[model samples]
Target: MSLTRLLPILGWARRYDRDDLRPDLAAGLTIGAMLVPQGMAYALLAGLPPEVGLYASIVPVLVYALFGTSRQLAVGPVAIVSLLTASALSPLFEQGSAGYISAAALLALMVGAVHLVLGFGRLGFVVNFLSHSVLVGFTAAAAIIIGFSQVKHLFGITTERKDHFYETVEEVVRQIDGTNGTTLVLGVASIALLVLMKKFVPRVPGALVLVIASILAVELFDLTDRGVKTVGEIPSSLPAFGLPDFDTGTMGSLIGTAFVITLVGFMESIAVAKVYARRHRYDVDANQELIGLGASNVASGLFGGYPVTGGFSRTAVNDTAGARTPLASIVTAILILLTVLFLTPLFSSLPNAALGAIIIVAVINLIDIGEMRHIAHVKRSDLIGLSVAFVATLVLGIELGILVAVVASMLVVFARMSKPHSAVLGQIPGTTSYRNVERFPEASVTDGVRVVRIDAALSFVNAQHVKKLLLGEADAISGGDVTALVVDCSGINDIDATGVEALSEILVELDERQVDIHLCDVKGPVRDVLRRSGLWDRLDGRIHATAAMAVDAVTHPGTLPESLRSLGIDERHDERPADTVDTEVSHA
Candidate 1:
């Protein structure tokens, strides 16, 4: 690999245009202002101190600017990754304890290590196993869980964290009467302010506005005395570089969580990156992205921060604010570094209720009811997978929930492949083209000939299924007197040993029944497999270039159609040896 490929900034930095500076600066400032509240809020969501979020926003953003492929993806503490961090670590230690914080940082390191290994190994395609349905369902469920997990902060009530979402809901309901009037009012007002600003003046950073107003309200009115919780005394210095304690047992326990975070974080980051890359008409290398994100997470871990990834909302804001390159991310990181160094005191009086409100508002859109409805209309099987994932995530904890979601997605895939679509084909009038007879009722079939197509690669899992479907189609023809069967191999791109064996069996059965079997449009790979299996020699004179040619051979006997003659085939072609004659026919 080249130096420029290893460090993406090396490629883009040389071409850095001065004209982009103004817009990059503006976008950086905009996101930096927005990240102030969001980073802190997401940190609290992850069960970490607010300063850790600031720490993450700084180092991760800068690291991604150096290694990341996207020009505008602003990397930082995202809500989903934060929630996963908490889910992974909360069982091992008390939330926000020194040990818990260290474990969180270690998790970031482990996640980054996994990403780097996958990137180097060129295994980035492994994430394809996480199908869209699974992501949608898991994201919606996690959003709900994250939203409700903030109720205690929002209402200023004391409640123990529960393992399951329903337990949390029940605890919230049981403690509803203990809600602090002051805190509830502030949180509700904060939510209202965020909503209004988003609707009316989306260009402004609403979270920042809410954070400032809430801090002023708490400080001016002495709200803490009335039981309004505030983000007390954040350290007013930049995070010092350090390595997390790597206890073997803790590392072993965290490996699974780190893997989950690695996949989920990269999926979220790449999804947004691809969207922006397409809009800008640029390319994003997936493996290179893994390396970038891996480096960013490693930086976060070393700098006293938790795991981070590309957040969709922030990336959208970055793009809309006119970020043309990763230079904008570096600028944002600098702004965050300044906040850590000089502006930490301003947030000391910030209300926890305001942060809770911000988190709730941010995650509510992730429910994605519109996407679920669209999935139901477009592919109900996928809806089943989505529903399974949603219910599993809610019933099981987030860690096991994701495992179940992946399994459900795989099962859905296997189910589809095992029973893939197959159709009886018929020739359209006045054309050599063939189509599904069921779809095109006007298309007519030739007497004593059966044409069938299976729209999936043949494998052990579906070989028997295809064999039965093909034979059934041959038998179901009117009068059941089929003299010839034409297998359309256009859709069969590949075949395994079991598939070749199944075809051999079908050929034998057809021969016993006195029906000639012909294969047409056989893909080169499938043909090679058949030849190696010694089936190609048995299929010698039966294979043709197209279904139309096969049908004409059986129907017209010694005469060649004008269309076939136009392709330069002579009348005496069939008189040649089977190998020579087959070689003479066009495979196009």
Candidate 2:
């Protein structure tokens, strides 16, 4: 593909037409309705005011719609991100305080930088480290954290500590005797009402209903007399744009936390983009997505808001609501802006407990217990990676959790291919192609030639392992039992700089050992890369027309060997998505 042709923005938007506007309008209205409650709930989850939530959904959504590649990805504050914001900022300042909000804005700036860098570099693949199992585990753990942290509000008890799950439970138990009956009653009622509405009202934005009911219940009962806290009077105005107070000391204090926020935000945003791309049957540009997401956060930071991204639930809602262009997101932003201008004070009586309840219910859905089971059954190592990430994230912190998952993923990949499968090959009795000799007992081998397959991409991570495997194979064939060698190159799909350098070293060793090396079945792309690698011209052997032809030539130089001259081999190879299918030569 040409570099100029690879621009995703041009590919999709250039073809967009007036026909796409209705779908965009429908999606905008649906997402706008959903965003109002969800945004406020997420803001509360992030330890911000409900109004700030409304602010985050507005301009950021508009920014992402303009710059993003996804047609339906909805940019806004989300549950997980808000929880992450709270975790990152709670220690630095009092929740809901001015300093905390400023920190949140600074965090958004950092997240924006991360996204911009990754997107430009096309490094979206970084999210692959957080596998499905790890994600499930982390989400489950976060749900528990969100639930437990809100217990104080549930009991109408004021406390100033952050032990996350266990400490919250301990604090609740210690204060159990002091729990206000009125507050507990309110909390319980809110939870139940929200659950019932969500279960039955499906498309009615259950959160909006629950919030209204909670407010009405609190006001009707004059719950403040019994010590229940409300959201208080929110400023009914659009967000004001400003920069975070950036003292060097402040930056020093918060840079580490900001990096964690950046990483988590990137992971989340890219994941949403990937999901939409797959669903819509269009390729998303990772680099451009980075820009879109970065721009959103940058915009959020400027507007007294925290870091934002392509929210999973909102994006799904946008897609299901029939968003056909990025315009839907922009319109959703307009809706939020209007809410900020008119409806902020309606939330003055919304109980913190209700917001917490919404967060807890939402986060609980993220944890996937069945996925852990599947990983444990199919791949214990991967399950371990997920488990380690979960424990680290819970016990250590958010930053450590993400770093551990990345390290674990890389380690798993390296360990598996370290001693990559190198095998002796021969022709099966009733087949014409080569197969691993160990797997096929009835196989034939050319008198002095052995074929081996290396099954993994070549890179610095496994280059040394390949070197060891090649040396061992050379020694194994050293009884002068093998003189000619053909490598089945079907499994080797990619090669890197380190791999080419390693191949050069390996070739030198093979030449010294007097084992002439040849390659066959190198796919077109892989072959082109290798040709550029300069390994082909320097090798002491040939690229075969076919593995079968190479085998026959090894057995018979002038005339076909008696064993092969009569029995013809299928030299024409067909490609399939399944793992390699090879016919072994008869050793019998």
Which candidate number maximizes lDDT?
Answer: 1
On the 0 to 100 scale, the lDDT of residue 1 in model 1 is: 87
Residue-level lDDT tens digits of model 1 in 178-230? 99999999989999999999999999999999988999999899999999989
Instruction: Kindly list the per-residue Cα lDDT of model 2 for residues 1-588, writing each as its tens digit.
Output: 343333344555678788889988888987887777777778877888878888888888877876777887888887667877887778778888988888888888878887777767778776566676667666666666666777777777776666455566677788778777788877777778767866786656666677778888878988777677788888877789899977576667767766666566666677787888898888777777778888889899999888887777777778877888888887788877777778777778888777766766666666777877888999787876787778876776565666776677677777887767677788877667788888986777766677778888877778888878776766666333448777777788888888888878878888898877777767666666676877755641355545776766555543312232123221223332233322543321
RMSD (CA, Å), each prediction: 3.2, 7.1
On a 0 to 100 scale, what is the lDDT of residue 371 in model 2? 71
Query: Once superposed on the true structure, which residue ranges of model 2 sit more than 4 Å away at CA?
Result: 1-26, 121-133, 163-169, 374-380, 429-431, 437-449, 458-464, 467-485, 493-545, 558-588
Candidate 2 TM-score over all chains jointly? 0.82
Error at 17, model 1, angstroms: 1.3
